[model samples]
Target: MRPRRFGARTGETQLRSEEYRLLRDLISERLGLFFGPELRSSLERRLRERLGVRGLDSFADYYQLLAYGAAGHEEWDEAAELLTTHETYFFREDYQLRAFQQEILPLLAKKERKRMQIWSAGCSTGEEAYTIAMLILDSGLFEPLADWEIRVHGSDLSKRCIAAARRGIYGGASFRATADVARGRWFVPSLVEEGKSGVSASVRSLCHFAQMNLLDDERTNLVGKCDVIFCRNVVLYFDAAARKRVIDMFYERLVPGGVLLLGHAESLLNVSTAFELLHLKEDLVYRKPLASTAKP
Candidate 1:
């Protein structure tokens, strides 16, 4: 039986057990994500909006519409947008950036190619990706590697978030944590057109934004291999088994000796055996061991 919510005019419009089960099943099948019962209220609120859009009052009706209606494809996108969380900021975790600047960039500079590629997986609004760009540029690494291709790709499941990232406009609330020097160097203050401040063209051009669902194997394959993948604050939403599976996928996507950065709360200890955990003075990172290093 599902728990009931009291003190509501609508009574316990709480998602029924069967509805919860169906939602979990559908989301897992479509996106490899499982939402526990604790997220019932959030799921209910999001689904309620979809139901209202269709003028349907029951979960069963909404499910049927999603399953059999011709517009089911559109509904799938709407559901993804509703459920995908997009909480991120410029240099949200400073320690990881410090390690990249002091450690990773210097190592890459000695490599024959002198090129570096980074992917900001689940990048919410381009802040993290742009933050990486600033770090690389500020470290004085770009000049020597000018001949090498420097690419930063930011991808998320939410099309809306991708659209916003592509626009590169942010409010003061988003910049509160940003350093004053970084703000002056990376962003040019613009007129309060439409009541919002804008960033400079230079910072905006550093990243390419795209809509990608991590669970889609083909979509993940399309991204190709990268040197550094920052998939922070994302896998905690999944179960243990799902987390392991996703971590394995990341391992395959990264080049040998490539780095993987996670959120402060996340770790690769039990989740993956393929990665060699590396502890820097400033941050914790993982590396996909080179073939020779992995061989017995």
Candidate 2:
């Protein structure tokens, strides 16, 4: 059957009351991304393009495609990429990072473990994970950790972003917040793309990437426990319930005494109370309680 076509003005129709509720609810349930009344037009505009692509004239039809179509799963994935934000760059939040480097790393170093793991949850294009690895290498704390296991894992909901991450190549915009010293030390000229550079083999060696939905319990479990988790700027998109759920998952994924770093705009104030807020010289971070009364 020929796909339905829509006129310029027809596609511009406001998302209907029922359609808005249906689409928003479905997206929230599946992806944990909440779109409220304020975002109604935004959601309508973004999905209208999808409807045009699919040759469906109405938002209702698009909802049917997402909810009951033969390729519903694939459709959801595409919609997710469209709806989610991937605005990130290397060393985007320097203050929190400085705290992680100056204060947190030293504390972890004292543990004297054979393996160390750091997770960049919601890691968009892999910069955060690579940055953590670079900092670890720069700290020179791991020199004494030779023969020890060290891995920085980055996970995101966008498959495309994860693919870009695994390739380990980036261009100028991804380096906007990056320092020249870090750029010089951790990346070399890219062989495949002119004017682009790939993360140095040494940095890439310690990092891994995977496509994962933060709301997926089984897949999230694969992330296991980590010493530090960077989930900055991600929970802002979620509603209260979704935010709480994700926070609970983070708590589960972090080992005792593990650290949780959030964006400057986000905090656990009412979202959660399980974590203790620790103030560092550069930033404030959260941590799980240690088994003992004090640092081991």
> TM-score winner among the candidates?
2
Question: How do all models score by TM-score?
Answer: 0.90, 0.92
Residue 17 local lDDT, model 1? 78
Clashing pairs in 1: none
Q: Against the unseen true structure, what C-alpha lDDT does each candidate score?
A: 0.77, 0.84
* Candidate 1 lDDT trough over 10 residues, lowest sum: 1-10
Backbone atom clashes (below 3 Å) for every candidate: 0, 0
- In TM-score terms, candidate 1 sits at 0.90
**Among all windows of ten consecutive residues in candidate 2, which has the lowest summed lDDT?**
1-10
